[model samples]
Target: MTPTTIRHACIAALACAAMSASAHGLKPMSDDELSEVSGQALLSLTNQTYDGLDFTRITLGADIQLSANLSKVRLGEYSYTARNGTGADIDMGLFRFGRSDGTEAQRTVNITDPYFEFVYKNAADASKREVIGMRLGFGSIAGDLGVQLNAISGSLLINGGAAGNYDSHNDPLGGKRWDGTTCTSTCGLTLSQIGQLTAGDASGASRDFFISVLRQAVNFPGVNAATGAPDKALEGFWMNWRDRLYAPVLNAAPPPNLPKPPG
Candidate 1:
């Protein structure tokens, strides 16, 4: 081949290699595949009874469908079988389900290289740090975080201040308020309830701050399961917390004798 042609070929090969190296593990589930998965997950949960509550048939919600996302959205709806302590049937009409496994084949999280702001939220005490660190649990929590973070409709639930849940106000991945979603009457968690999207860069900036930190509380750096393994939180966290809370009476002697048995 000619010199110019050979050089161009080399450049093209290198570019292809780079693109391949930057790929993600997210893949779009086929309709059938999603259906099967959703069904399996739903079935596994059916006929199960909570200690104080009983629910009726579980069925798919209208919004349950595949998205332009790596994860599938499986919304489900159900109501109570009978009145409980509340004295009424407060049907959990619809709730989102986490369906993505972290082993998808394309379009996934670039967790190692995400552009993050060093958001320094105050930790009220050492317990908060322990709690935050422990939350990055393995499949139990971190996998779920990965699934949610990559969801097209990922949410950030505000704990109070009349904010039900910031469901659609965040970016598909970063969970940032992207310029708009007007909340004239109610800034709620559902799409129908949202007022409008961020109008422009300036408006978006303000909204980003508002939603990113509405009723702000303690927040720490979020751990990405894709980057590193999460810690075993139950034992590790509890023991550490106990040490911090309890005083050490070093080299203390045991009781002199076995105390009389309790009556």
Candidate 2:
């Protein structure tokens, strides 16, 4: 064919490819691999052992879409539930998902309806305000110290995008800078006892700080549906929307009663 003719043919092919891409959608590697009814995530509390109570798993799947062109997986109306039917109900709350599995990509992961409930084993003090994401406050996002994304080459199954190099970890409990890591102890406390600890503080305040969300990463290691291999993790994740949350108010009289500083 003549050079002009060949050029025209290439242009047509490129246009066709682009159109096809827009018409189709991409899903996570796990979604493509597993034939289960819904997306699932497994946690090995004792290291790859599920026959015991230490192992926990949850269901994670929704209208998840993937885009190879953007190198991102966007969760559209996604919500994760407890596989055992007695765990937290979590969901991603945002759309513009960026890559979080690289050295320098902006990972802006927003959360919604997040929860966490685990036994606080061996805590030295119980009267102090417990916090998560850090015990000393302020460090690198590379470590699983608090509520952050899974590291590259790790199997944490962050159901979002492939990954870039941006660290965006704004913990709901702590804020942008925090280090007080402590989970509310629920291991041996009865229902009534647990209430005593968090309900009526020494100053007569209530447990309205938050509903206590379990900031966890839905990890599905061992088998991935995408590469058909055991890739430590599926990179990072991102939601496709946002919503407002509501709760009953407490301590409404604080501002009115507190001493006014010198104007």
Candidate 3:
């Protein structure tokens, strides 16, 4: 089954458990009891507000290892741009993580605190309440990301280089070369030339990443795909974050020795 389906199934199971507990006379565990637990919950829900937006966040607490593939993925399709068909910020096919023939560790993506967050504007008014955006992020990730793109409208930087085939002459994949001695302008690298894309830092260290889609287009600074120059591009979808997606610090010190949970 798909990763999304599996995740939703888990959430449904948790909801049913919560309902069953409410239906029965089961009392919630005390903080001390909860503290003694060795494992985290499978799911958690949180609601909050910030910057005039209301956020409903569903977080999956497990540290997961998974392998999956998507036949196609199209995000933020709006106006029809000649260079970007369907006007999508990200339009790709055969998106996959890991390899089928690899070992378990090699074929699996390690993800922590996977979360889905929905942003709403005018949430106080029923008729006016609308979901303005949604995002999927991981507190941290370590994995391989395989994809084939038909078109992309926003910035997707990798290894400190931009992913596109545009040049200052507005040519596709014909911009200043990568040799650094070329046009003395911006360099554009196609997905192929960028090689296998791995989710990590320059040193291959794991890090946080986020993928988001919004109703309103957000202007972001990126290389002009058509002209190979730095410019602002408006897009309603984007992936990868230059900062942390979630925190509490991944390498925080463990608490002092405590009693283990009852067997």
Candidate 2: worst 10 consecutive residues by lDDT? 136-145
**lDDT (Cα, tens digit) per residue for candidate 3, span 29-121:** 999998887966789888877555677878888788767777668776666544544456577655666554434455766778888978777
RMSD of each: 26.9, 22.3, 15.7
**On lDDT, who's better, 2 or 3?**
3
Candidate numbers sorted by TM-score from highest down: 3, 1, 2
Evaluated with TM-score, which candidate comes out highest?
Answer: 3
Give the alpha carbon lDDT tens digit for every residue of 197-218 in model 2. Answer: 0111133212111111223322
Ranking by lDDT: 3, 1, 2
Structural similarity to truth (TM-score) of each candidate: 0.17, 0.16, 0.55
Q: lDDT of candidate 3?
A: 0.53
- For all candidates in order, the CA lDDT equals 0.25, 0.22, 0.53
Cα lDDT, model 3, residue 259: 26
Which prediction has more favorable TM-score, 1 or 2? 1
Q: In angstroms, how far off is 61's CA in candidate 3?
A: 0.6
